[model samples]
Target chain A: MSDFLMFSLVPMTVAIVICMSCALLGNFLVLRRQSLIGDAISHVALPGIVASFLLTGTLASSAMMLGAGVSALFTVAMIELIRRLGRVENSAAMGVVFTSLFALGVLMLEWNEVGTVHLDVEHALYGNLESLIWFEGTSLAALVDPRALSDLPPQLARVAWMGALVVAFVVAFRRSLVLASFDADFAASVGARPTLVGLLLVVMVAVAAIAAFEAVGAIIVIAMFICPAAAARLMTDRLASQVALSQLIAVASAVLGYVLAGYGPGWMGLGVSLSAAGMIATLSGGFLLLACLFGPHRHRREALST
Target chain B: MEAWWRALIFDAGYNTSLVTLGAMLLGGGAGMIGSFVLLRKRSLVSDAISHATLPGLALAFILMALVFGDGRWMPGLLVGAGLSAAVGLWAVQAISHRTRLGEDAAIGAVLSTFFGLGVVLLTVIQSMAVSGQAGLTGYLVGSTAGMLAAEAQLIALCSLLLAAGIFVMRRDFLMVCFDPVFASTNGVRVQRVDMLLMLLLLAVVVIGLRITGLILIVALTIIPPVTGRFWTDRPLRVVALAALLGALAGYLGVTLSSVREGLPTGPLVVLACFVLFLVSFLLSPRRGILATLMAHQRFKRRVHLRQGLLAMARDEAIFDDLTMRVLRRQGFIRRDGVATPSGWAAARDAEHEERLWALYRQYYPEESAQLDHRGLLPIERVLSPDTIMVLENRLMMGRGAHP
Candidate 1:
């Protein structure tokens, strides 16, 4: 039983951490009218992940995160450039840039024969969250022990690091971020460089996305960024509460999704465990639907309040 | 390389030729329909709709498998996809209308949520015991190598209908896209036209699913029209050019993928479109980046040269030899480094213009006025003689300066 608890503990914690951090940043994105940027960055991260693996020939988390960060920034830059030079709408620009980059990533993966047993297109697309195991005993003492600590899943540590970084960024820059989102020109008039704040926000979101890519897959990360945050937006009328509520929703969905993925099929007599990431995405999407349909708050609040 | 060359020339095999032709047909249709979608700024809606089709496709397959013991019928699956896409489109509209969220958020929410549902359905299908389920997976990334001649025929037929439909209502599509309110005032039934366009877009997406897959199929519609916009502004020409570019990209991508054993066709096709877009972005005559930059540089240089001439006119500076040469070459100066008759007239005119601007700036600073650098607009030309007299009187009173 302890072994079972140990096996599921790391994946569950990582899932919750990934969801919570993404949901927190996602509220800002939804408020700023840039929610889709998270989806674009996650899609573009595929190329970054593949390029990192190719260049370093290792799946080291740092290399992957760095590569994904570069790729996400490049994607953002390319989208802006396309919108300017091509005179295309921003959405079309995003569609063109990320799809082509994703395509390029796939081609590179095939050409380099990077589809080894450990890393392949399927793993990149769907992820292998099941293998996020820790050899530590299921106890607080074991967690503190250096040997047991060393045996922990590396993805959990990365998630924790990103979670802390995201939290610090939000706490320090909340006022400026809110000002920028509400009215950038007004923010500028008040001696706040809205452009810098906006850039920092995107960079932070990209960082969180790159960190979560290995554990939850790109698709689920997109879900975490949009669904819970959107649902939270429906539930509340304040930015701080939206952020906190989104994190709560994300944690609940993670817990529910993990349990359902593990045991729901047995209850249905299907005797097959489904993909945990997909289950989490579905559950978060369900939260969004419920919020859309039945959230008690119906009065439209001021736009920036979210 | 030789194999690639052979494939490019249709010497690979009959199957290769058929698949390439099918891809081209699908690309042409998607490109044409995508022009309207891009112009209408509904590209994101199309994205949500396409993603929504995945779950519908899976549901269709599941239902057909359980009911008829055969789920591989292409038409039934497409009908399912179309229905689901319509639902997704309706959801996007409803969300933006019913909630405080903007359209972008609605698009993002619907896109991710529907795609998430599709993923769940996909896993469910994979776990089920069913035959003919293998081909369903190809709808995710698309496999051009697995395309059949029958499917190619369907794509060709759809392309024919798409071309004809676009030809019939090109004017209505144009009017509604540019000015829906004006079109409505003219009794053009804008909503019906939008519905027709939506139907056509759905058809293109359905055909494209077999060629490019769900995730990247929106690219076929978006990239071509955007690329075409670089070349022209005429609606029909843009649509025609987009169709041509789309076909070219489709042909080349399939040729390359056929030559390489492991290359995925859908993304390769998108990459090909992107390369074309990149070329057009850099080199197209009208809206290309290079042309815009050149025009900007030319304007800057002209401004610099004009500033030099203006200073010389005021007797505050003299031209360098290089400046004189350039001015002489452009017939703005003479060979002896002195002003010609026209140049002298221009110099006096420039000096007079400067005084007038200075008078206006000093006296009427409250009313921001812009100077027209291209033309020597004397105050008399822009204002009536009586108004100029009044302005001169006011200026003399206000500034204690003479013009």
Candidate 2:
């Protein structure tokens, strides 16, 4: 029973932590009307991973992160350039740049099969939770650190390091991030550097993406980033309440999804990860629908205020 | 270079490239219709349809597999894509009319949920691995290299039909796009026209899925129209230019990929379209940045020349000497320091000649015998004393009456 608790409950707890952090960070993105940027960055991270592999010949977390961050920044820059040039709409530019980069990454992977790049593709697209289970010894160490301090397993140590980094960053920069997100122009007028705030957000997203890639994969990371925030948006108009609700949604979805996946089938069957991601998306969508139906008419408020 | 050309022209693999081209042409024509979809801001509907079609595809595959014990991928894909498009449009309309959700929000809800359902269905289907399921993943990811001659031919036929439909209803479609209210008031069946346009959009998206895939299909539909906008203002011209641009991008993307082993043609094609848009935005003659800047410069020069002439005219003592030099330089002024006949005539033309006559008519509709004798009075004392005073002050100050 304890083993089951450790296998299921512990993982669920970890997933909630990761997913809630993603949703919390994603709030600013959604509020800023840049919800699709998460999707773009997620796709753009492909070339970064591939380039890192080519340069280092191993998927070291740091190298991959650096590559992803740079690529994501590039994608942002391309979108800005497109807008400044006034040649195409912002969304179209995003589609073009991210898709092209992703295609390039696919081509590169095809050209060179250093080792299991195809499997990495699948992992990047859908995530490999089994691999995360094996490689997440670092998280376990952190969980047990208060009770017992021993030489921790390497994988668990890494997970713990990443988790702590994420938490610390969010807590440290919450106010400024929220301010910049709500009205970037206003933030700039009031002596906040919108660019700096934007960079911090992008870095945060990239870090979360890398961390989640270990568990859920890259393609569905978008679901984690977007779904909870979208759901929260429906439930609350206040930023604080939205953030809190999003985290709640994320954590709940993670726990429920983990349980279903664990008990449903062993192997060669529909697993919990994809189902969980899909469920979260569906549920969040449902919440938004309900909000649209029953929530106070925010559009009326907007019209009156304007 | 010669050997490379030969290899490209003669290789068996080249057949695949040709088939892909054929599919793209068909797809591009469909995309031409789909551009109207994007312009209508119903872009996300295409996405909803793509997602909604998944169940149909799965059902078709399952039915075929159970009955014939064979998986026929193309037939299944077609049936699935067509059904989903129809259902998606219906659902969009139903939600909007029956519910209070705005169009964008409704679209967002339907697209995400349907796509999620498709993902769920796809995961289940993958586990089964029926014989026909081998290349099913490729359908989502898309692989132009696998296209066959028959598929190409079918796509071409669809493209021709779409083109014909568009041609037949060009005027109605244009009216609808510009102002649906006006079209409806004028006795056009706006609803039927809109549905037909959407059907064309659906057909294009589904057929293009063979090359561009579902996720990036919107890009193909949108990019061409946006690029074409930079090149023309007329609707017919815009449509033709967009189609040509799309075709060119398709050809270039495929050709570039053939030169290299690793390039994915879909994104390359999109990138090419983006480049064309950028170039047109910067350099096209009528609406491009360069043209606007040039016009601004020219306007500034004209204003400066007019101001310089006015400044010289205000200073009568220095005017005569500077007038000849300035006039020679400007070409509009004359060699004489005093206002030459041509210079005076040009100045009068530039001033409010129409307003001066209107003022004259207001005060003196018929002959004014007293004012007709010009030399009998001082130039300032001509007609109504107030009007003459105002005109004399403006002429002496060298300020144009209109400005």
Candidate 3:
């Protein structure tokens, strides 16, 4: 029972935290038509994580966070530069820059005498969420004991901070973010610097992405950044309700995905635990599909209303 | 240099050469089909479709294992990829056409969701204890180093079919791209033409998926045509140039990967295409960055010179010395800084343009403020239909102050 709680319950909490944080910020990304930046940033963050390992010789959180921050800023600047200089479309520029960065990360990992270390491209692509166990004080009794709170895994703590940072950022800049997302010129006229607000939002996204990278992997990070928010958007028209709906969906996906990933294989006679990150992403996709077909604002109804 | 030449020609191993040839063919076919896709403004739609193939591929693998007692055939996998990609494209079209979500949102939704589903399937496949299951990861990040000659031959055959199909239907494709409403009115099957192009896109994507991987395969289709666009405007020339660029990227990317020890082949090819794109963006004679900058500078210089001439013609005290020299050199002014006859005529034209600009500023404060004084003069060469109509009405009213 302790093993079950340690393995299943703790990871589910971590997944929920990661999902809610990503989905909250994603609501604005979808509103601003910059949903793909999530995809671009997560892919580009691979080299950041790898570089952090090479520099520190350990997978330290602060170093990796700093690396991810630098890499995200660099990716944004490069995408803008490519778009301006090459006159390429925004999506094409994103595709080119992020893929090159990811390839560079792969090459670096290969050059660094790969298999001796814990990091690998495969791991980065699909994370090892199952390894995030409560090893410090593994007991169901730890849950009720206030002293045992400190025994929480470091990754869980990091995600908790990430969640706090996301909430703080949204609260601090909610008005500016909303105005900038809807009308930049109006935002500017109203003393809300859209560019600064955008930068702050991107910083939060980078933090969230890097924090979740070890727990959820790059693909799930991208999927959470888009699918939950998009599904919520289809369900509502107001931004506030949309954000609420997105968080609800995200938490539900995390819980459902974690349970299914743990138990679904056993039921099917495979006798193997699958990847929680992949299952969460898949479940989020399922939610998006359902929302598209049967949500309050179905496509045809949206069209007619508009 | 000699070694480089040898490798470039025929000295690379048979597998290397075969892979390179296959890449080149795939690139050419994607380039041609991508032209239509780009024209349709569905560049990102192709990305969503490629990602959507993952679920289909996994599904095919499982079904083959369960039903047919075999799961690793190349054709079966590709068939699954193609079917799923078609569904993805159809979803994109349906959502964008039917909903207020717009194309970008629809694309993001479909891309992430389909890929997420695929990732889930992959996890399931990994736990099934199937032998050779690890190879499925190759589709995510392609491994061209281990491409077999038989697979290369298949790529070549499919590429050839794609090329022939596009070649025969070139006219119809062009017509549809240029104006679908007109084509439909002319009794051309526009939808059929569109479906044909989508079919070709699926073919190219499935083959290129092996060579470039799913993550970067869209680049093979998108980058080449955008590069071609910088150098030409003619439809045939754009297609030809795109095909050439794609072939070059394939050849160079493959060679680079072969020479380097651990470099990924797909991204290397994509980088090669990007390098070419950057070159064309900066150096193309007509639409290049350098050309645009030069044109802007030349326009600025002309504006300064004309402003000087106008000042001299008006006898304004703010006239500069360089303006006087340029006006004198052009015989627009005498040595005494007096306007000559030809100078007066030119100055009148310049003054008229200024008046037009002044008039333009009243109506569009922001737009006219952004323009230089001479910006409106170019419009005199080919008057806008609205402007022409306005001028005719003014003339009828006997207000003879022509701009």
Candidate whose DockQ is highest: 1
What lDDT is obtained when candidate 2 is compared to the true structure?
0.62
List, residue by residue over B1-403, the lDDT tens digit for candidate 3: 5543554785878878788888888888878877777777677667788888998999998888777666667778889998988888888888777655667767777777787678778877876656668657667766676666787788778877887788788788888989999999998899999988887887889888877778778888888887888888898778888888988898887777777555567777777887888798889987788988898877766766678767755768535766677778888878987778998888777765555555556656887567664452555664466864564464445445543
Candidate 3 interface RMSD (Å)? 2.4
- Candidate 2 regions with alpha-carbon error over 4 angstroms: A1-14, A113-115, A118-121, A135-203, A210-215, A265-302, B1-18, B42-63, B82-116, B189-192, B255-265, B271-403
Higher-ranked by DockQ: 1 or 3: 1
Q: Write the per-residue lDDT of candidate 3 for residues A1-306, one digit (tens) a residue.
A: 777776776688889999999999999998888888888899888888888778888777788788877888899998887688667678867766776677667757766765467787778877877887776446778888767766677888888888999999999899999999999999999999999999888888888888898777887788888888888988988899999999999999999998898888888877787778878887887888788788897554523554
Q: Model 1: residues >4 Å from true position, as ranges?
A: A138-141, A298-306, B9-11, B65-72, B131-134, B317-349, B352-403
Cα lDDT tens digits for candidate 2, A1-306:
444433454445556666776777767776665656677787778788888889888777778778877888888887776555545556655655666677666656755764365434445665544333322234445446653333322334544566677678778877677778767788888877778978877777877776666555654466666666765765667877888887887777666655544554445354533344444444555555555556553232334454
State TM-scores per candidate: 0.89, 0.73, 0.84
Best by TM-score: 1
lDDT of 3: 0.79
Rank candidates by DockQ, best first.
Answer: 1, 3, 2
- Clash pairs (backbone) in predicted model 2: A127-A216, A127-A217, A137-A156, A138-A155, A138-A156, A138-A157, A139-A156
Calculate DockQ per candidate and list them: 0.63, 0.23, 0.49
In terms of docking quality, model 1 is medium
- Candidate 2 - CAPRI tier? acceptable
Ranking of candidates on lDDT, top first: 1, 3, 2
